[model samples]
Target: MGEVTAVAQALPPWVLVVIAAAVGVKYLGQALAEGSEQWARILGPLGRRWRSRAERRTEKEAADLVALQRQVENLSVEVERLTARDKKRGEFEEKLREYLVYDANWHFRAQLAAAGAGTTLPDHMSFAQWEASRP
Candidate 1:
């Protein structure tokens, strides 16, 4: 061990420095080359295709959303129109009921008079009661 240490110590310091520098440069170059190759493998033509596919999907989703929004707006307008029509129909039905009730009352009164009945029923009596009292 002592002899080996003496021989190592006698070697020129610049020779050891040069050997260390060569090994360091070799390893550095290898690392750089491997890193560049790995990057190329991960981010080559496939990256561009993936990006384009994603963009197309986004555009399609946006178009579908706009169409759905338009459909909702049209449905809202249709609902409003139908609601107004239903309201008007209900009012017309109420008026028709009133007219029918008035006509029936006058007809009942005239029939009682023709039958020579001294007592007349109130207009509010049910049709069944009026018919039962008829001669």
Candidate 2:
């Protein structure tokens, strides 16, 4: 008893607390060995909690991925539509330029005829007529 007291006095208070905790854990472990009902009862909830959290995280990630895929699909469709509209605008501009050139030539020939020149040219077609004449 005297030696035990001396040893206890030499150790720090924290060391004694650690020893007590270890003894308590050992007793509990002995009471619940592998495959024991008490072991499952004590640790099953912790295992289930961890598994449920993982499942929820996986489900949320899958949902976010699906949403991103849908957004990409929508953007792709919009890009296709805009590209087609841009192509049509280019065609319209080209047609407008052709008509301006034809009209200029027609006016120049008419002026020459009015000034008593001998050469003649075809009459200018209207905008709609010019468009209908081309493919």
Best by TM-score: 2
Per-residue CA lDDT of model 2 for 1-135, tens digit only, reads: 999999999999999999999999765554453325455356567444444555677799999999999999999999999999999999999998999899788797687886677655666776789899999
Q: Global lDDT of each model? A: 0.74, 0.77
Please write out the lDDT profile of model 1 over residues 16-60, one tens digit for every residue.
899899999656554444445553345555444444555677799
The segments of candidate 1 whose C-alpha lies over 4 angstroms from its true place after superposition are 1-42, 116-135
Candidate 2: minimum summed lDDT over ten consecutive residues — where? 31-40
Per-model TM-score versus the true fold? 0.52, 0.53
Local distance difference test, candidate 2: 0.77
Colliding pairs, model 1: none
